[model samples]
Target: SIDRKVGSQLMPDTSPGVSRSSQLDSETHPHVDDTPSSNEHHRPTPLPAQLQGRATNKTFQSMTYVPGLTPKIAGILQSKVPEGTVITSTMSRSPPPPNERSSVVYRLGCKGCEAKYIGATVQKTEKRFSKHRSDVRNGILATALSRHTLSSTGNHEFDFEDFDIIGTEKVRKKLMLLEAALIKQERNRINIQEEFAAIDNCYNNLLLNLNNH
Candidate 1:
C-alpha cells in the first residue's frame, strides 16, 4: 500500500467569500457630507456681522427718508416765541400803549442761500420766521417772501406809506400772509431748489441696513 499522508491539512476557510467592503449593506455605507457641522454653530458667520454698524451718522447723508411736510406736520409746528403776556411799567400812572407797526424782517438762511424779507406779523419776530424756514426747507415756498412788512419794534421799526401800525398780532398774521402771497406770486420767479430727495434716498438706504440688522 502506498503512503498517502497529505503534507499539511489545508486550513479551513473561516472568512466569507465576499470582501469586508461588500459585506457592508449599501444603506449603512458612510455618506460624504457637505453641510456645516454642529461644531461650527459658534463660528463667526458672514451675514449679520457683515451688515451691522452701517448708517450711523446724522449728516446730510443720514437725513434721507424724512417724510415730506403734510398738513399733519403743520399741526405740530411750534412758535419760536415764548408763550406769555408782555407787561411794562411806565413812569406815568397810565402804562404806555404797545407800539404797533407794519413790516417785520425775516432772515431766512439755508445751507448756502440766505434771504431777507420785510413782512408783517401778528406774533413775535423769531417765532413767525421759524415757520418760514420750515416751509422753505420743505419746498413749500408759499411761506417765504422777498419783501415782508410787519409791526416793528425798537431798532426794527420802519415806516411804509401804504402800511399802518396794527397790533403786533395783526402784523404777524399780515406778514405771514404777505409772505405766503409773494412766495406764490413769485413762485416761478424765485429759483428755489432742494437736494433733500437725493439725501433722503441715501439715508433711506442706511436705515434699511439698520432694519435688516
Candidate 2:
C-alpha cells in the first residue's frame, strides 16, 4: 500500500480563472486614488477673516469693494486703515436778520415832542431807518420825515431806540394805506400833507364821539 502524502500542501491552488502570480501582484500594489495631493500648486486660497462675508464692500454705500484679499497677503502688505471719502455736506441757510425784514409798517417817536410817525417800506426796515438817520444828520434828503425833522424838530437823532414795528404788508398801495390808517389811529402824528388829506373828517368825529363816551 503506497501512502500518497502531499508535501506540505504544495502552495494552495489558485482559482481556475485567475493565475496565482496575478493575485500576488494585486495585493502588493493597490489601485491609485484620483483625489488631489496636499503638495498640489495653483490651489484657490480662502478669504481673510475680516473679508469672509460678501460685503468686502456690499449693502453699505460707504464701503468700497476690495478683491484679491487674503490673510497671508494682507500680513505681507503690512495692513493699515484706509483713508475715508470726503463729502461736502451742507445745511440750508436761515432767515434774514430781524431788522433786515421787509414789507413792514413801522413807527418813529420824537424825543422832544409827543410827535409820532407811521411809515411803511418795501425794502428792509433797517435800510429805511438808516436813510432816516442819514437824512436828519445830513439834511440832504427831502423825504417827509426828514422835512419835519429838519424844519420843526429840535432833536438831532430820530430816537432809533424807540423804533417799533406795527404791521406788515407786501402790496405797495395797501402797505401805504395801512400806514395811513395807523396814522389816523394815533392821537398825535407827524405825516405828510397828502396823507393827512386822505383821512375822512367823519372818522375823526366818530373817534372823538367814542372817546367822549
Candidate 3:
C-alpha cells in the first residue's frame, strides 16, 4: 500500500523509489539509454585529414593529404595513368633516340594527285596513330586524308603498320629530306612525259597542215 501519484495524466511510481533494483525499471532503462549517448562521443570516425573524396562510390577513409613530394614520388603518380595519354609539358627536350630499322610507306598514288607522307610509331604503340591524326588535322604533318587515315576508311582495314622509325633528330631530318628528294624525282618524270606528248602532237599537226597545202 505505498502512497504514490497515479492519475490519467501522470503514472504512479509503484516501487518505493529504489535506486538500483529490478523494481526501479524506468530509471534503470533510461540509464541504459545513457550508455548509447555516452558512446556517441567515443565513436570512431575518420579525421578530416584522413578523409578522401569519394572514389568511384566507396569513400576512401584512410588517405592523408601530403603537400609536396620528391620527384621520384611525382614520377610514381604520373606512371599510374594508363598509357596513350598525350603528355604535353613546358620542358624542352631532345628528340627520342635512334630506333631499330623499320619500314615506312612514303607515298600514295592516284590518277591526278600523289601524296608523299611519313606516319606511324611503335616504341609505345597504343596511341601513336592518335598522335598522328592530331598532327595531320592540326597541319603539323602533311597528310593524304583530311581526317585520320583510319577514320576515312570507316574501319580498321586501312590501318598501315610502320615498322621504321628514324629515331634521332638527325635521322628524322634525313628521312624528311629523302622524302622531298623522291617527290621531286617523280615530278621531273611526270614533266618529261607531258613534254614528249606535246612535241608529238605538234609534229603530227604540222604534217597534216603541210599535206593539205
Candidate 4:
C-alpha cells in the first residue's frame, strides 16, 4: 500500500512511522562528506618529465681532489660529458689527526745543496718527514724531492733535521695553495736533474692546467 501511494505521486514515502522526515531531509539537503578536500598548496608538485627522465638516467660520480689537478680535471669532465648524463662532485682528502691538523706546509732543505722542496700534507709534520726520508732511502723516484736526493747526491739518506714547518692552515685547500705558491717560487732554485725534469714538468703542467681553469 505504501509503495502504491509513493508510486502514484512518484515521490519517496513521507508517511509517519516510515522514516519520512529523514527521507525528506535527505532529499532537501543531501549528506555532506566529512572528509576534508585535498589542499593543492600542500601537495608535492612532481618533477617535469625531462627532469624526471634525466634524474633516472643520470650517473653520479665522486672525484677526490688531486691537489693541483682537481679543478682542471673537474672542468674537463664537465665540458666533455653530456649535461644530464654525468653529475660530478669533488671530495676533499680524509682529515688527519688533531695533532697533525696544525701542521700544514713544510719545507725540506738539502744538506749538501741549497735546493729546497716545499710540500703540503694533512698528516703530522714529523710523520710526513719520516715518510719522505723513507721514500728517499727506498729510491722512490715518484716524488721530486726523493728523486733529486738520489740523483744529485752520492748518498740516498735525507737530512731529517733539515726539514722545518713553514706554515700551518686548518683548510687543506689553503695549505695546497700555499704549497703550490712556494713550489712556483722555488722552481728555478731547485736543482732538479735533467732526467727528473719530466716529474717536475708533469707537476708544473698540473699547476698550469689549474691556473688555466
Best candidate, TM-score: 2
What C-alpha lDDT does candidate 3 achieve relative to the native structure? Answer: 0.36
Error of 2 at 211 (Å): 7.1
**Alpha-carbon RMSD of each model:** 21.0, 24.4, 22.7, 9.2
In candidate 1, position 161 carries an lDDT of 22
- Candidate 4 lDDT over 1-213, as tens digits, reads 999977889775667677876666767879754457778459888898777855555456654333445555666776887573433353368765433545466667777766777767787777777787788768787677787787874553456665555555567655655565445545434523442332344567656555565
lDDT of 3 by residue, 1-213 (tens): 234433532654465755445545665575553235666789887757535663434322221111121233345545885432323232166533323323221332222233323332322433544555575556562343333333343332223253233121224444343333333333322222222232234444433343344
**Which of the two candidates, 1 or 4, achieves a greater TM-score against the reference?**
4
lDDT of each: 0.35, 0.63, 0.36, 0.61
lDDT of 2 at 123: 96
The whole-model C-alpha lDDT of candidate 4 against the native structure comes to 0.61
| RMSD (CA, angstroms), candidate 1 | 21.0
Each candidate structure's TM-score, on Cα atoms with residue i matched to residue i, is 0.20, 0.46, 0.21, 0.40
Better of 3 and 4 by TM-score: 4
What is the Cα-based lDDT of residue 74 in candidate 3?
43
Error of 1 at 211 (Å): 60
Best by lDDT: 2
Report the C-alpha lDDT of model 2 over 28-142, residue by residue, as the tens digit: 7667444687768767798987668755552323211111112222444344433323322222677356478788778888777777887778999888888887877897655
Better of 1 and 2 by lDDT: 2
